[model samples]
Target chain A: MASACWGLPDAFCQFPAMDGKSLLLMRRTIDGTFRDIVRSWSGAIDAATAPLQIALNALERAFTSTPWIVVLALVLAIVWAGSRSWRIVAGTAVAMLAIGWFGLWRDTMVTLAMVSVCTAMAVVIGLPIGIAAARSDRMQRVINPVLDVMQTLPSFVYLIPVVVIFGIGKVPGMIAVVIYAVPPMIRLTNLGIRLVDAQVLEAAEAFGSSGRQKLWNVQLPLALPALMTGVNQTIMMALSMVVVASMVGVGGLGKNVLQAINNQFFTLGFLNGFALVAIAIIFDRTSQAFGQRLQQYRGAAHD
Target chain B: MTDQSVPTLEDEDEVATRPGLEIRGLYKIFGPSPSRWIGAVKAGMTKTDLNRRHGHVLGLTDISLSIPPGRITVIMGLSGSGKSTLIRHINGLIAPTAGEILFDGTDVCRMSAAELRGFRRSRTAMVFQKFALLPHRTVLENTRYGLDIRGVPRAEAERAARRWIARVGLGGYENSYPSQLSGGMQQRVGLARALATDAEILLMDEAFSALDPLIRLDMQRILLELQEELHRTIVFITHDLDEALRLGDRIAILRDGRLEQVGTGQDIVLRPANDYIAAFVHEVNRARVIRLSAVATPLAETEEAPRLALPDRLVLEEAAREMLAAGAERALVVGPRRRPLGIVRIGDLLAGMVRPSGRPPTDQAPTGPRGKP
Candidate 1:
């Protein structure tokens, strides 16, 4: 039924009433008989969602409960480590501090935690699927349409099913964000591995590299830049989901921004919106910079 | 004909004469279902007819050659001529649609996955056209990759790789990545990598094609020098005739999925098997290819020539120069250990050097009628 939740709204949105039931029956059987399918997960949802719910809650609390100074220093240190750019690190520090001054610091951390967890989960799940799709034609054919649907589906559409299953919390909100962010990683990873030089692969085969050996030693190393780009896009996509997902009781910087819209307070909306943008800019610039470094390293390696 | 000699520890020299690799009745058809067209192809259907009727491209058709041991067998052809396809079959990179690739006496096509792995790791190594070095790895790492795949201990593989790197004249650049090297240097890394594996057979598929001409020549000389001592069975693929002539003890020419001719370099140039082959050989510098023994008169009872003993394998150009310098009409063409094999007259050398002047053959000629497009 956790799976059925998404199928219900998908069917509801497509036909509402117009289409026939062969497709309907197919959907029904797939998600378990359609009649009470939505309700089937009510009992099981709590247990099934427990581990993830707890994990995300702890993550959100960890970020929000930390003293402002320690979080700021830790983040700046990471940014510096990755890019080795004092300017960028300084910029990130200023941006994070500005959010604190705007009284949106706690909410900002929650949003960051949500985005981080979802994007991590997306990559963790998507990368293997991408590798599988790259390796086998049959798997690619099967994964292609599923990815197409996943990518093209509106970010808001999956929220309905997520809300039904996880019942309007950090967990469901994360599910929505992950579903939105995952496709790019999958597509780019598949494309990257597929685009690896044919002759290089032949060289590996000529050297008697086992399939696993070839993937690890040759394919993955060369695919790093493109995979990093995929990661960048996934991070951006997850960030974009914050505002929409907050409607499902996801308390964060998004919820603050939502309230600004509801209350029609110009200053509130502007400040909170600015905070969101700052966070986005921090992640986006860092990821893109890291990706550029990877590209540069890769360029040195190519003909 | 085969020696069929059993291995005796006493005669290590006999091992060098046994055939290292053999391709028998090889056919490769490219399409959705190649098996459907294999029968028609084996019965001698034209490549065009097969493609028109079945949409299957004929890549290689009935390629058979006995590649002699410890010598270079150059498979030469223009692009789309299946030379690449033929080289690939040697190391089992491409499985023939139907044929047996006999390595030593065993059929490579019949090898199981494990056996194929063992064969590739222990018997054959390859150099690629584009110098396919792993970009991220340093030159030393790239050189050690073949041995690494064979599960050689890191220290020993690195030691062997270092020696090969220096042999290819890339001694100090071991720590640099492949990207840091020039084309010639990169190819050196590629060559070192292949050689470091210590495989008995080396498959070089246009390995020097991408290098500048001077560098290409340098690499050819390097390979020749190395082969002098190593005696590895090398299957070298090339589109360039001169390179083929210089390197090949035996040359097999292919055109559009069919074997045009297979013979020694002199046999190819002096007596081409067909008109198409005649055209391929026509523009080639024949004096550089024709061996003295190829044009030599048998040692007869008529006249005792000046005692200018030359190796039977000296090319016509070199022999011509030697003969003209000595002001002699003929010279002794000596076999192994100076046993007189035959006599080569200067006139025979001059006759073989003349360019073939004639029309191209019109019957069953491959690619098209006039030979040259």
Candidate 2:
């Protein structure tokens, strides 16, 4: 009997696969092309992103230099404005005070600044793309797979590309955080817009609403709840990236946690981790409350 | 052309003066390439056959109708019969795969995008079955939506919206959101919104169908009362025969996306065009729909006309009631200016109320027309 049972060569009996050498060559080619592009375009890219860096620096400086009491009061006021709940405001105040008690207030503020900047940038970039996807099936088809990859790929994999392109700094770290965080914003916005009542849209069109008018007047208003959820999710994701972002020379609670880890300071690591959790809770509660407030009209009792 | 069968304005001069919508040879095939299948459809491919062969759903086929200006033309059909699709075509919300929608000698189908926008903004407004009011907008704001789209000044738009809101009997609910109101009230807001636009054409797609029966009757009365004053060319769509009979100055019946018949309520109830239409009208309350003129006998020169007179436009049910109340066995059916057009007896009125037992005569049949004694 022949060794090849299916009447083929023995080589065909094994699964056809690329050898390691060919795989390595393909990877090298991709890496080399990216490196060349970064070498040629680094200065131009830095200039383009200078405004983002400036904004981040300004926010960080403002948070750090401001009196601790003033900053605490401001945070409480914002929580109050968003939630209109004394309980949430008191909880946020207690968390902030606890962080300050641990001597990590400044680091907490720095992380907050970074998360805020990343979130704002993600929203600004994601909203229009999401709206485009909602309006066109072809655009949606193209965007959905990319969104899936961005969401499912390990966060560290894209950080390498970010480091290569922008070098180690706050801007590159912010870029990495946005890349890891923006899928929810884009996905929810697209879903929200697509889910608007078709009959309502028909009424809008029947009334001769121009496309721009419909988007501004009908779509955005109806999609506000989902968009707010997207904002909340982006904030949470950006906060989670703080520890990862510290590897790029970011100075924040994440940096302290990294140092603690290296030195085996369990207490210090836990303290910094608690501070991060505090910030996340405050943001999550405030944004959720604000989102609910925006949709108050939907809850009115029928007469 | 079957155009003669369509009811015209009583005064021919008014027909010439007002530019009504004339939909000619309209065919809408819903598919990836709708225009490509228009030839096969026009060649008399049945809706089902076309769908089975080409995976193209027929929305409307060969719909030719002349909607008289300043009157209600109700397009009646069951669900999936393309009544909604046909109404959408009137406002250019849905473009026909093949046809011309003529208004004021301008082909609406051929209008540029900007021109169509202008036409919809300035000439037409619509009410929906589900009352698609913006949930976030208050009654006042929702009512002003159309005017806002038209770029009307905010103050002026609100003023007009307020007037119509009050006109629709939603006087004190201006600040309430749509979710805060009942369905009937929300539909009132929808009506007010359309009315506030001051558009000449009002397209109401099952505007009252979602309401309870009593509320529906109330809405129909309100619509008729408003129509008496406004006289906008209203195109109403409904699956309810009773509603169609109540509202339509001329009724058009549709089946499987095809135009089955077009005429007045009396024409449809007394003389359906085919068995399909006859079956549709079979269970309708005929006495409430058929007017006395349809069943009245021509006044003979040798006989005396009855002293008790009723308007020829009155339905048999109402005429019978009036005759019974007056204890009269007979009445003269009067036309405009109390002119005696015919005579109707109580026996004939009672007989007219009952559905014909045998095969209902179609328009094309040679037998003498029933209900025209």
Candidate 3:
């Protein structure tokens, strides 16, 4: 009986409150229902059609993409230059080229660019705050909470507010990457400065070092190893943010993979996924190798 | 660096040196609140009483001492005996709650920050237990650090540091980092740094303790050689009695923040001031702390000099070693000028070693300053 009353025909309830308006009001009510039905139908159609367009786009980009062999050659050059070893260079080259041949280079570069921008922003913004944190306890206290929030917030949840503010775009996606990548640098800097031996500080002071002199001469140099670790972690985190960023219009390997999944294209999805891993490995190894080189040079200089 | 030349032995003798550094009735009471009311309420309280009434740590108290010029004065104590704190007071690393620390004629506690900085930069150098070399700097750069702080030209400081590094036996290792050197070598760098400052006083806080046993002995020998040349008044802090005996011209023992005793090595070892002191020295090898002059009697016959001569300041153990090495029955005990004052017979040394009493019992030993129990 309640369903019957609630579902009564629209014509009975469309009577106007004033004279000569009932018929027009009834007709308008009928039109409103019909418009709602059409909108619903169109929304479903758009949702269904949107993913197909994305796949077609991904497919076109993948074919015209930088060839796997060419990208492999570039990677080989970098690895050989860095390590002076043909075997390691060749190995890296082969891995990257295989991912590319399997059709993943376009998505891979998208992830690469995202990681690059995020890491750059993190370094630019975090280095000074880290310096300040090292200098003052008050600044450290202020930065600590922000760092805590960035570190503890769920990865998926990072997009909610970013999406609201920037409205889904590469900028918002890049911002998300920065938010995830910055905490490590700030924390490592503060810890490195704090961990510097007190006796060293005394020696510096005895030598007549002013506050700034001590920071530059003693604190910063000693803290370099730890800070490099922070940089490495920040880069790794930005890479991890690639897939998360794609949820907000970040069209990259992550988006391509997402399109492949929606279309049930197993080979396409696997290729993109493997390429993402390969890119991550390449960056991780390179950054770590660079850090090792830095350590060796700095260690020798100190010696 | 000081404008004046380093003093020779003769000049040091003529200085009429009273106390290069004096701590008069020093006190450091660590409490949450530094209020007169709280201090008064806790006055005359025992450690337990203080702990009950207010959580406090008495790091130092009534630490009256005088480190004489051109002599090595060691403040010896175990951990928590306030030896480190006491030394820190000399340079105002920690300020005393109630007392005066007079460095030369100037009151250290009263100095303004700028004045303190000037004094510290130009006049005093400290060697920590850890070598504390800046890990980033080369040995030469580390040594130059103090001079650089003093506004010396970089070239001049580098030159000075290079000279000091060579002096400390690290001539070729100047460009090496602290990490690249052995512990002993690192300490050599620290010593070079302290010496390069050309400070009037050198404060060493167990500077050799971190080295291996063999390295420590080598460093100790090196220090004696340096002292013979430098003649700087040194205040060395250590818990090792043997080290204290070996290096200290005068030794002060601290217990629970109080000055238990202060005397020359012979005085402290032969006649400890109290039970607390006696307990501390009880197990110490007496053959190490006592000196030849301490147990030796003046020569009965002035006609002939003793067959052998030994410094009056050498430990009885060293005397015994000398006697054994030389196969001599006795050695002449000499004053600072190498003048024969007495003789140390092997029999006398053996007798001294036999009865290595912790404290001189009542009515049997000299009493006053350090001998009293």
Candidate 4:
């Protein structure tokens, strides 16, 4: 292909070939300085990141610690309340029981825990950044290019650094999932806030709503549908990371899927894949239902 | 048809001036180097020239108006005329590049962020053209929002909100959301929310512009009825000439971000300041826009015989109807307490009903000062 070159590109090929390594000379020079900066603030950084471990543990326990019957009942009740439809509740109950009967209950819960934690971390970090971008054009100018790069880059290309930095573990895997999935959260949140009607914001400002009040009462509430869509996308993206995440030692249905892929075990792959779908259905419906409920109230006023 | 009843709801009395919201020397320029060109703008540079030479858009230039309280002071213009910009300045929504806005003697532009918030929460409330009701909140909750944000107790805010909801005729739809209401009803909710705030000043930025023409008129009547009891200092913004003439106690017209003319409806219709203002007011039917007092002739010794009595504040349309109904050629235009001030001839009012094509038809300029000497 290079030889052919559409018949005339010798000069183009002969043009100065920039060494990729030389391009990063500044980074190489600053690498030690970056380490020093990290070392100097390691304690504060650790303290800040420590809550993340607790969040992970909390999600794990919330999904896994309770008795199976208790967990099943609570989950069914929530599903029932959200849908207010007996048929959907019954279908969800049967689906959950079928996965349990297949001896994949523990694996399913572990996957759920990781996805839950990743989404939580994504929302926590991404929302404020999204809001900062929405509020200030300068911030948007800084973030938009970075967000565009994050979206366009293949998610796997960033994994080498994640594994190198944090080493192979659930933490590193969670970080990777977060990096891959968090962009949507930030993007949609920024869009939602930006999309708030100009007149509404004017009214809020005219009435003397404080920045904090406007954020919570007007901007956040109005942006909820968009935010919820972001959350929904984040969850789906996180779930997609299950098999890739298992490569770093996080145990879940992803591990089983990975094993099936290695050995080409069709039945094992299909069952686990079906189980993932069942779980996805549950989470998707609930969040979408909640968003719809919010919209209904807005509609109900004029109804 | 929408304005079903003739709004004979007023007694002939002039509103005493209450200088509450005053914008003095207020100017706004859009773009990076506005300060560099503002001097040029003030030195007779055109808005188009400023944009061409320096890429700066002059929004409002040397706008000064003392908006009287207990009356609607409307800022009116065609699109790109900076009427919206001027209204926002009153509430500090848009900070002026130059000059000051004094709300009840306090400068709004100089207020600290916290002070501004407090002022916004307590002192002024605005209605929007698109019925800026919070979609998440119910009609009742939306009404309670201004008070709620100011940290009024839930029960107390709800009560005040409930009273206003009923007042705006949204009694049973308290729990209903804004999206469910029609455009007119949604604006009613907007009105209720502002009224519930109990703010001293009501800034309505083209508040009725979104409604159907009939609905808009209905909203105007409702606002007029409410203003009779609650005379909040309303600063209304509109591009519609008729709405401004109907609602504004004192009208301030803006063109190309500069104040073109400021006067009563009678003043504007009878005497437009320049060609731009003259063209703007030329199409307005004087009989419908002006009152009997504006066109009434002083009773001469020979013409002292009164055939019928009408309030001086009555529009010539109503006065004409009354005079014709009473089978009289002319009617006594009385001020307060039925005291005769002047007499209005039916022929003059009939002539007024047809707006002149390009210029005011009559040489007398009965209502406002004539443009020509």
TM per candidate comes to: 0.86, 0.90, 0.77, 0.86
Over the stretch A205-299, how does candidate 3's per-residue lDDT look in tens digits?
A: 66556777888888888888788888888988887787778888887788877788789999877777777777777776776676676556355
lDDT of 4 by residue, B1-373 (tens): 1132223223212234444777788889899967787777777888788788788888999888878767788888999999998888887888888889987678999998888889889888999999888888889989998998889999999999999999998899998878888999999999999999888899898999989999999999999889866778899999999999888888888888888778888778877776788877766777789988777888998866586889876888888888778899878887644667788787878766666555655664433221111
Model 1, residue A75: C-alpha shift (Å): 1.0
User: Each model's DockQ?
Assistant: 0.44, 0.72, 0.25, 0.60
Considering TM-score, which of the candidate structures 2 and 4 is the better prediction for this target?
Answer: 2
Q: Which digits, one per residue and each the tens of the lDDT, describe model 3 over residues B1-373?
A: 1222233345656545534887787778777754442355336656555666677676776677888787789899998888888888887777777789888789998998788888888888989899988876788988988898888999999999999999889989887778888889989999999989999888898888888889998998899888866778899999888889888888888878888788887777667777776677678777776777788988888546667789887778888888889999878887655666788789899877765434476675544433322
What lDDT does the true structure give each of the candidates? 0.84, 0.89, 0.77, 0.83
**How much is A191 displaced in model 1, in angstroms?**
1.0
Tell me which of candidates 2 and 3 scores higher on lDDT: 2
* lDDT at position A251, candidate 3: 79
Error of 1 at B1 (Å): 31
By TM-score: ranked, best first: 2, 1, 4, 3
- For model 4 the TM-score comes to 0.86
- Sequence-dependent TM-score of model 3: 0.77
Better of 1 and 3 by TM-score: 1
